[model samples]
Target: MTIRVLLADDQALLRATFRILIDSCDDMEVVAEATGGAEAVALARVHRPDLVLMDIRMPGTDGLAATTAICADPELSGTRVLILTPSEIDAHVAQALQAGASGFLGKDVTADALLDGIRTVAAGDSLLSPLATRVLITRFLSAPAQGAPPRASEDLGALTAREREVTAWVAEGHSNEEIGERLFVSPLTVRTHVHRAMTKLGARDRAQLVVIAYQSGLAQASRPAQR
Candidate 1:
């Protein structure tokens, strides 16, 4: 399936550059472009693209607020947001995740990495840059209340034991394949558990699931390994 993408960036040059790159790909295409957050949301509502390649900093509304608006809209539930920013600060990464972005990538990433990130997020997997992952683990997930309100443990009571286990691994930044390898299950089985957990907990995506895992005390954040 072709991945329909909406490019949201204030820079016209960046938008055009991305448009060219995305349109060149066989499995993906640029469906629309927006210069700021409000326009991004409007275009998103109109186009209902599979993914929005969002920039965090913009003139109005901003990408974080736009992400929140897009993710919160039930009509746009199938749409995913992938935050692309020049600054991958801790707070920005945390806020992007909280706002329901399925992925975060630094602007400096290679074209291949950006394309891969888009595909990864469109395929229903969360993609975080290495720095973003570290920030998520060491800052936000470690102190979930700082990023968002904490969920009571009973909120997690709806999840099965395996689902809870899978969620914890997800919080620790394990992909479905990695979680499956660790748990002696197939990746598809792991995805099933993830979907079940999301349905039970009312999570928007894996990123939100990670937030809930920490907030509900199903997962404890720890320092990421040094590369």
Candidate 2:
């Protein structure tokens, strides 16, 4: 199946460049392009693309708000957002995940890496590595945004023990295969647990699941592994 994409960027040159590159791929196609956040949301609703390649700093609405709206709409449940920014600032990465982006990538990535990132997010995988992901979430999401209501730890009550375990591992940025290895289960089983956790927690994707795990204190950030 072709991975339908909506390009959301303010620069026409970038959009055009991306369109040419994406359309060259047999497995994906650019279904639409939006110059700003509001148009991205509108075009997303109309096309219902499989994935949106979103830029964070567009005028009016901005990518984070647009991402929140798209993820919250039941009609757009199958659609996933992948944030593409010129700068992969820590706060932006954290906010993008909170906004329900499935993955985050810097615009400076190679053409192949960008294409692979699209496939990864479209396939419901978070793009960051386990250690990097943990550090980012632990640092940024550990504290609730100012004036934002505190999230209840009890909100995790709906998940089973195994689901919770899998979610914690996910929050640490472990892939299904790695989690399964630790649990002595197949990757498919790990995926099942992850999906169940997401369903129970109302998570938009693995990235949001990570956010929830940190916000609810199910996962704690640890020092990065010694290189």
**How big is the positional error of residue 212 in model 1, measured in Å on the Cα after superposition?**
0.9
Model 2 alpha-carbon drift over 4 Å, by segment = 221-227
Per-prediction TM-score to the true structure, in the order listed: 0.87, 0.88
Stretches of candidate 1 exceeding 4 Å from the true structure? 129-131, 144-148, 221-227
User: Per-residue alpha-carbon lDDT of model 2 for 1-227, expressed as tens digits?
Assistant: 99999999999999999999999999999999999999999999999999999998888889988988998888999999988876654687677787678888888888999999999999877777564575777788888866766468899889887888788888777888888888889999998898889888888678888888888878853212322
Q: Which candidate leads in lDDT?
A: 2
Q: In candidate 1, what residue range of length 10 has the lowest lDDT sum?
A: 218-227
User: Clash number for every model?
Assistant: 0, 0
Instruction: State in Å the error of residue 39, model 1.
Output: 1.3
Give model 2's TM-score versus the native structure: 0.88
Mind giving the per-residue lDDT tens digits that candidate 1 earns over 24-136? 99999999999999999999999999999999999878998999899889999999999987766657667778768897888887889989999989998788654555455
Tell me how candidate 1 scores on lDDT. 0.83
